[model samples]
Target: MNNQEQNMKFMQIAMKHLPEGKKILDDKGIELNMDDLQPMLELLLNVMSEAYELGKEESMENKS
Candidate 1:
């Protein structure tokens, strides 16, 4: 409805699919250090940008 309500709804939906903190290191044979966090974040950013924009487009229909 309002900006605050919209943000809360977005967070609630996003949290369901967010990776658990420890999951970033799930590969057994592969190891990652602090340097890996940036690349991981970049990949996630691309996915989330598409997801959030698609959600916003859907919400615009409701607002109309």
Candidate 2:
């Protein structure tokens, strides 16, 4: 997938799990805030994107 598609997919996956994450934090007496999570979420997106690229490259190399 292209960058935009990859980002969208990553965001979808993150959002899917966000409620569970919030619940875990809530159970631990931690408050979950979107503003506080923005930076962390960005970092996670970057990591996921990079990992996807790396895996794609590896797959292509294996097919060579």
- Writing each residue's lDDT as its tens digit, candidate 1 over 1-64 gives 7656755665555455545543645644456654765565556656756687799999999999
Best by lDDT: 2
Model 2 agreement with the true structure over 1-64: per-residue lDDT tens digits: 6789989999989888888888898999998699987787888899989999899899999999
C-alpha lDDT (0 to 100) for residue 47 of candidate 1: 70
Quantify all predictions' global Cα lDDT against the true fold: 0.61, 0.88
The RMSD (Cα, Å) of candidate 1 is: 5.4
Compared to the true structure, candidate 1 yields what TM-score? Answer: 0.52
Off by over 4 Å in 2: none
Clashing pairs in 2: none
TM-score (C-alpha) between model 2 and the true structure: 0.85
TM-score of each: 0.52, 0.85
**Candidate 1 regions off by >4 Å?**
1-27
